[model samples]
Target: MSVTNQTTVTEFILLGFPGPSSLKLTLFVTFLAVYLLSFMGNTLIMFLILMDSTLQTPMYIFLGNLSFLEIWYTTATVPKLLATCLLETVTIPVSGCIAQYYFFFSLGATECILLAVMAYDRHVAVNRPLHYSVLMSIEICLRFSAGSWTGGFIAPLLPTILISHLNFCGPQKIDHFFCDSDPIFKLSCSDTFLAEALGYTCSSVVILTSFLVTMSSYGKIVVTIIKLSSREARKKTFSTCASHLTVVTIYYGTIIFAYVRPPAKYNFTIGKVISVFYCVVTPLVNPLIYTLRNKDVMKAFQKFLAQKRFLLTRNMHKF
Candidate 1:
């Protein structure tokens, strides 16, 4: 069908998870709670990282950025998802859909780069402990962080632009809850070869390269740990990398499975499940993973609470 002949689609209907009407309330409550938890948890992580001078390190700095990213990530999709649960049909204007698409992919790509950078940070800290500070200096950390953000913003530009220009005619229904590339691309009336090519190319370069870098970094860290003589020393050394490793596994595992594939091969059922994990569940779990596994974060949070209590008591006495 020619672009000119097809009817222009001004808005899209998102066919979110379909279930019995009875389950609507349960679904809405579940997603709403997840969104709030993700928001508060990530906010707390960022706040603690900023206020606590004790956490002023390269690792914590990257974590603060990740926390900030997770907050926006959930915001990009969950609200609309909640709406779909409550409403019969969830409609989104074309411009709004495009905007959501851009921010979601950009943030996701930024996280990929950040995770790789974090892995490299761990690599340096563990393998070259004596020179870690000198190697991963403040200047270096800022440059890498800035580069990740910049790369993320730029990486999706070509693909998103290509996708935006494509014609979306009738039957403007997106299978997924969000305005992801695959679903949007599937709806286009024009030839989507270029968009798909660009998307797949970008996904491969960003995801595969980042995954390899992370794996390589961890491999080196493992090698370095084995060389240590003391059992306690080795255990302690591995502990530092544990939280990051866990997060990396969860993030990359779901994303790679979801995006790194041909559109024709995409199973809607599996894609929806994987999308929920990466989009909803992962963000909520991130703060828990970091806080519970990390003593420093827990201590900092406790101290913050104690200080607030003390201030409240002191102010009450004055009143």
Candidate 2:
């Protein structure tokens, strides 16, 4: 149907995960478990950062913002995905799809910027330990956090607007689990050149810029760590950033592959598989990575548990 004659699509069918009917129950269970784990893990990180006085430093502040972002990040799509797995044929209104894309992109961009900020934080800590307190003060941390969020939210606005205005003439089925750029662009009948260009530009600027910043910071950090005479000093310094580096590797690797490609290179099947890593796995693993690797977080968690137990015991005695 020509764009001139056909009505714009008001809704889209999300062909969520091409799989056998027998796998739906497994997929639902798996996604549900992932969502819950991601939520609780990130929430615990936020809670520890808030309550633990020792974790009130600039590093943990960035971590807290990340955890908070992860909660909403996973929330924006996972629940809907869970619903889709259960319902079989999932249809979304145009507006809802747009909203989902905006939030998902915004949070993702925020994470990129935030991760760079964290790398810089570690740089200051390791290379300029004497000036760490002065360099990464509370005010500066808050400003960086606010700027990351603001830039993230603003970056996607124009592209999202462009995508939403495109006419979907027919075959309004999104072949991916969620409303991603490639799948959405593939479905549109309108001239998507401008939209695709804008999407690529925004994605490259956000991902590449942040990736460079993160790598540069880590590069400097590695040099400084190598300069340290004591092996213990070097090990300790690298430990601080190991988790973040892991997350950065996973996130940038997946996102760059997913978003920065030319339209011709899009493989929807592979795209969905890669999407699961960043979308479902990254958020779920972030808290685990940080906590399992960092002694400070473990100590805080133990302390918090001990305090809760003490209070529980005291209350029981009173009762």
On residues 1-319, what C-alpha lDDT tens digit does candidate 2 reach at each position?
2588777789989887867867877998998999899999999999999999999988999999999999999888887788778886889998888899999999999999999999999999888989988999999999999999999999999999999788887879998888988888888888999998998899889999999999999999999998999999989888889999999999999999988777679888998889889989999889999999989999999999999999999999998
lDDT, candidates in the order shown: 0.91, 0.91
Clash count per candidate = 0, 0
Poorest stretch of ten by lDDT in candidate 1: 261-270
For model 2, which pairs clash? none
Query: Distance from true position, residue 42, model 2, in Å?
Result: 0.5
* Per-residue lDDT of model 1, residues 209-290, tens digit only: 9999999999999998999999999999999998899989999999999888876888876788799998999898889899
In angstroms, how far off is 137's CA in candidate 2? Answer: 0.5
